[model samples]
Target chain A: MKNRLRVLRAEREWSQQDLADRLGVSRQSVNAIETGKYDPSLPLAFKFADVFEMPIEEIFLRD
Target chain B: MTTGHAKRRYHLRMAVAMAIYIASLFVADWLIEDRGVTGIAAVMLASVPGLCVAAIFWILARLVIEESDEFLRLLYIRQIIIATGIALTGASVWGFLELYMLVPHIDAYWWPVIWCLGTGVGGIYNKLTMGTSGNCT
Candidate 1:
């Protein structure tokens, strides 16, 4: 999956650690998801949507 | 609990298990070799270290279950798979060599040690390839 996580985080002036904290995940998980090394599960994707205050489609896209 | 807390507990449990394992080895050897313990009593004595080793692995298993981060959990499962592969392959190859009388016989207990060392190798691999050791630290 491709995601606008970096852009969104940048726009919000949030570091990866900040996003990770919001998502209750490790910073490494945020990095892996941002770098496209990993895809988030459905529940975690929902968490991302909740954290980003945007729809999952807005944050993540089909590759 | 948090992964950090879980890891701390894991370390503590592992330390206790290792101490017991070492002490059991010494006590078992003393009873069997010096005190001439035999039969069921000696067998029971020798099983203590193995049980401790099993408990150590059980603690690791609990860590995996306790880890909340999906990525970290995935990494841990991958590491375990890699470690299991290495340990089993090493043992199988060594078994063949022993069958052919090309290598000295080794105690069966060494396989768990190999598995433990393989986890270290897996950690190194995870660090190199995934940018994190996946150790939950």
Candidate 2:
């Protein structure tokens, strides 16, 4: 999976740690997802969606 | 963060467990030297290391339970599975070598040592493949 998480976070002036704090996860997880090293679960994807206030499809894409 | 507390506690527990393990080793050595591995003394000495191993298991279980992040928990589970596979493979290879008279006999305690090393290998595996080490400590 590919995601615009890094771009979105950058646009929002949020660091990886900031997003991880908001999502109640470790900063490493945010970094992994952003770097495309690990894909988030559905629930976590939804949480990202909720955090970004964007549709899941907008943030994540099929690779 | 939520995980910060849990991570700190985990580290603290691991430190204490390691300290106890080292201390017990000294005690076991002293007992063995003084008592010549008599029945009760031998049992007591053996139990120290046994308890240390059990403590390690308890710590791993506690990590799984205390971790609130599902993704991190999943990573831990994957690492443990890999560690177990490595340990089992090592044991099987060593067993066959011993049976064939290709190697000297090994104590059972070495299995746990190998398993612990496997956990380190698992961490490296995760870092290579997952872009994160997924370290519990």
Candidate 3:
């Protein structure tokens, strides 16, 4: 899975820690997701969508 | 939730349990020496160390319960599964070796020690495969 999480976070001017705080996850989790080292579960995807205020499909792309 | 409070509680509880476990070892040794490992007193003395070991497990269970982060919880569960697999496999291999008279006898209590070491292996496995340590602390 590939995601535009870094881009989205950058647009919001949120650091990894900031995004992690919003997502209630560790900064390492955010980094892993952003770096394509990990993929979020469906629920976590929804959480990302909710945090970014965008459709999940818009943020995540199948790779 | 991986809060500071939870981490502190885990450390405190583990420290206490380990202290009790070490103390129970001494007590068990003293009892066996003095009482010759017979009677209800010996059995009860032996159970004290086992109960302290169980308390360590209880601490891990409590950590799992108190962690609210779903991803971290999943990681913890995975680590525990790996630890259990390693411990069981080691025990089975050792049992077979002992049965064939190829190895010396080992106490059953060592299984938990193997499991604890397996958790360290699991942590390394997570770091290698997951690209993160998955350390809740």
Q: Please report the candidate that would top DockQ against the real structure.
A: 2
Q: What does candidate 1's lDDT look like per residue over B4-89, in tens digits?
A: 77778888888899899999999999999999999999999989999998896789898899888889888888788888999999
Docking class of 3: acceptable
State residue B10's C-alpha deviation in candidate 3, in Å.
2.3
Tens digits of lDDT, candidate 2, A1-63: 999998999899999989999999989889888888778989999999999999999999999
Off by over 4 Å in 3: B1-3, B35-38
Output DockQ, candidate 3: 0.47
lDDT of each: 0.90, 0.85, 0.83
Task: State the lDDT of candidate 3 residue by residue for B1-137, as single tens digits.
Answer: 45456657888998888898899889899879875887888889888888997887788788788866655666666777788899999999999999999999999999998888888788888788777655532
Q: Per-prediction fnat values?
A: 0.50, 0.83, 0.28
Candidate whose TM-score is highest: 1
- On a 0 to 100 scale, what is the lDDT of residue A34 in model 2? 87
Model 3 residue A5 distance off true place after TM-score fit, in angstroms: 0.6
After superposing candidate 2 on the true structure, give the runs of residues whose Cα lies further than 4 Å from its correct spot. none
Ranked by TM-score from best down, the candidates are 1, 2, 3
Q: Decide which is better by DockQ, 2 or 3.
A: 2
TM-scores computed on chain B for all candidates:
0.94, 0.90, 0.87
TM-score, chain A only, candidate 3, equals 0.97
